[model samples]
Target: MSAASDIAKDHKLAVFPAFHRVADRKVVIAGGGDEAAAKIRLLSETSARLVVVAKTLSPASEAAVATSGAVWIDRLFAPDDLADAALAFAASGKEAADRAVVEAARAAGVPVNAVDRPEICDFYVGALVNRAPVAVAITSTGTGPVLARHIRAKIEAMLPGETGALARIAESLRETIASVFSNGTDRRRYWERFFSGSVADALKLRGEDAARRTAKELIGTREHTGRVTLVGAGPGAEDLLTLRAQRVLQEADVIVHDQLVPDAVIAMGRRDAERVAVGKAKGAHSVTQERINEILVERATRGERVVRLKSGDPMIFSRAGEEIAALEAAGIAYDIVPGVTAALAAASSAKIPLTLRGIASSVVFATGHDRHSNVLPDWANLALSGATVAVYMGRTVAGKVATRLMAAGLPATTPVAVVENAAHADERAFTGRLDDLPELSRRSDVDGAVLIVIGEAVGEAGANAAEPLAPLGALLEAA
Candidate 1:
């Protein structure tokens, strides 16, 4: 088995880092040419104390310098000139001088932006879809400026100018409004309710007075409590998790997770949270379902928020129904946080859509590892059907399923895709004819989070696609 660290290095999707906004800060533009003038004008819109340093200034910049009385050092910019600045923009003579200014600014703990030179820039200037306080910045990691500007323009079209005005009005009343609710929980709920209501937009449109009146009329004195959530952890990978599932994981306290959940996702939980393992690796389920039930009930009964983290989405084949019934029977409050089912995750990682236009429109999720069930699946209803079929935990019985399915009318040449460690960084995919999938899975190095796909959709394979496996059982359950 590959180490988790190795997986992190592989199969990882791109994540964008957050950038701090320069709402009000000192900025120095170290030139007086048109480039410097443009930078200066943009800075003027902010609260930055603008300083322009250039031997010869542009007509526009010279006019601003004359009027505003900004200190224009009418001499060559020395590297030491940036000693006491917050941000520096250099568009001066010679690459050597610009490099010097950048190095000096770095030494002085100041951010420097070198015009048209991304390597020397401490921060890239992004195109803004401005709602002022609620502005959206667009950047392409310094690769595509035009693309970023285009995206900004698209965003600008959707966001109204009134939104900025509204944000300022909201900001003005924050101190007074914040004092009304001292409890952190109440404050969070209050804002959530405010944003969801049409009245928040009205406050932006009709001004603060209308918002205050509306808030008073609608909001009551009772404390609004946040809810405890129960979420599916997925088989292992963080990438396999649903967006909604990730959001809940990021917010919850006292996460009671199964052993199958990936540590990477657990790391995303609150650092101060109580993480108790309910059981592990699925074999014979170390913690019985009844015991897990008692834990969830007891924790939730105490008013401490709890999340029952099961690998994969809890709804499919998972006994979430029994748990939901338990929570209801115990009168304990809870909500379901759906996760990407193992089948979906595997399919996604394999780039094979479970459903396709005209080829396979309907999909069924079936279980493969039912130890107690003597009956096999309905071959007549399932075989050769024009639908994507996903089987969960069907590794051992995959060949048997394929053989029976083919005998029942499924063509021997039908395409099948099998994914091992689906959505995990160590994920590997195999594809082949239905007849050969069982052997492929047997030979694969995959040990966990396996899923099988069988349908005409498999025939729609693109380059760089996975091979196959006999994973009909788990796929059956997942569907």
Candidate 2:
């Protein structure tokens, strides 16, 4: 089987996930015990008009009904109780009574959930990580509910508390966005930026009024021309990506990325965004630079928000200048969102200071390979320069780099650090003398991205110096 098909097979779900629009709709609950009260607490947060049928009401159940403003019927549940209801919950705490209610609800063509009874439940109430208008329900197919709730708690902790407020603001501004943009794509793009960018920050730091004002200003100054945003994807970790980069990704109508950009990073873009891999490796070019430039211009001229996602910071050896020149020549509007370069991330991950007072007072970021010219860079000057050197795209030429540095009168025993897949879960770092640079590069198992750090400051901060970084899942939980 094909890989996608195999994945699909592996993910065969026990229940199809869906959300019901129950606002201003009728819902029925049959019970009066703690079980029934629990269901009432869950549903009370929504706008559903609830009716409770129970022979007896415990203090907890009565209080729940009062708080939820649900109608109470002091009698047994009947088939007609489910009539015209969007959903029905059975929690009488008796097997026979629960079964009767479930059957009646099903017969009335309403989905039913029986508390603590999965077999009879047409649907289960999953643990919710509620950021209203953005609720995330976690389920385990009516089994392992405790585990689901545990997972939900973890998710809840990761989300920004003000996300719900931001969602509410977005809801209130939907009509305004639609009116301003007209096109669905444009409207979506605008909101994506608003949610991930300064508007969301304004909402969090100031208030809804401030956010609304900002939104209005953005709408008034909306750019009609297609634009290209050169986004830095950061060093193999989604969390390392900047808020502006995330905003641009979400707003893009098309994403053109390098092969080094992680799948998780690309997945941050709009679900409907077109993804094109125009990656260039050392010897192999899946798509040429000229073609890439043409594609950027083509997409922009068609009025699409184009995001050129480059690994690490676009300004640092990422060939962003060429793309910017292309956009300028074509008269297309464009901007840049800087990302955390791999060098900094590598240094941070390895707990190595890029520059230390007295020991290393300066830092130089240099690429080992020059794509435009075959002539090697001034390696002697770079080696002799009394500064820390962070080498980009140097893995293939590690031996040559070491040889040149050594020949330039640098000590063979200069501290060298190789960080592979910086800031990622499987990140690996190797620390040794400069003489072992080539061997370290060869030994690295990371197929994603590699960065080499050479200087006296390499292990000055000590090995494994920084606190472990959070994984991509933690970063995505907020979104």
Candidate 3:
């Protein structure tokens, strides 16, 4: 499968992830303490009619209730409190009080969450990442609530802040699109383009006015207008991909990717999307550049949303220029989505800075070899420019590069850091003097893509940095 498959077929869920429709419906919270206040804050974001029942209220609980405009019943929990309620929260803190609330909710056929009492609870509350109309709920089945929130934070970073606006726009255009495209296939394709093509791009970059104008141009058009997007896969790490790159991958009708792009990154694309591996590696040319360009033109001409997935930033040495030219020649529309380049990822993995205030003022990105597979012509000058040089795909010629740099008045003890398969779980980094770069690059264990960084700045490996961030999934046991 190109994307996630049906997990229910091979595994079972401890608690199914479901959204309860509580708009204008009563949602009871049988408490008036800190625990109930938390639930009140959460439910307040929804359109549900919140009702809090308790004999007494904490200062915080009273404030929350007042802010949420909830009906505060100044009485003890009872069975009638859950009457006509869609959902209930038994968050009274006291074991007996919580149990009483749970019993009442169960008798009323309402799903209930009993704070810190999972065994008796009918449902579990998950950490929510909201991009409204589009919400992501993450849970560890009550085993880890902290972990779920951490994951939600990570997802929140990955998703664009403007996604909710885009979703609202798409929702507004549904009927118009449905009426215009009568064929089911055409309807689905149009929506896909609406989400992944020029309209989506305009929305993201130019706001609703441009997005509406772009959509208006597409409305009622019978002919399918195909386009191509050059997406940077971002140094083999799935999380490193840009938000736009992820969107295009999920919406692509066909993904034409390189061999260096890992399976994890490729799996981000639509599951049913056609995958054409037209990758080019050393001594292997299963598909030439000319033919690859032809393929992009052909697919896009047929109204397919094509994603030309490349390793690292496509604009840098990915030969995106040739493809762009081909698309232009064919009069096809195209977009370019930048990615986290390998050089930047490699420096990050090695914990080194490419540019320092006094040590190094600039950084240069250079390929290890040219089209004919020869080391760069002026490799020595780049090394002697007093700037950090980040070399891509240069492992095979590391010896030649080191020799030339040393011969051109560059120091043999120049600091060098080499990272292979950067940002991946199996990533490895090596640091040494320029004299050792040849042996380090030639190591038998180096299998994946390699990036070589050379400069005095490589020696200053973020020694003054702050403490590292915590893992995304830390232990957080919550009911």
By lDDT, the best candidate is 3
Q: How well is each residue in 349-399 modelled by candidate 2, as lDDT tens digits? A: 888899898788888888787766332447557556668888877777877
* lDDT of predicted model 3: 0.85
The TM-scores of all predictions, comma-separated, are 0.61, 0.60, 0.85
Worst 10 residues of 3 by lDDT: 470-479
Please name the candidate that would achieve the greatest TM-score relative to the true structure: 3
Cα lDDT, all candidates:
0.72, 0.83, 0.85
| TM-score order of candidates, top first | 3, 1, 2
Q: Is candidate 1 or candidate 2 better by lDDT?
A: 2
Task: Pull out the clashing pairs in model 2.
Answer: none
Across residues 220-279, which tens digit of lDDT does each residue of candidate 3 receive?
665678889999999988888887788789888899999889999999998999999999
lDDT of 1 at 41: 65
Model 2 misplaced stretches (Cα beyond 4 Å)? 1-38, 51-67, 70-86, 91-111, 126-139, 144-224, 237-251, 262-279, 284-298, 319-340, 344-389, 396-414, 421-428, 438-449, 455-479
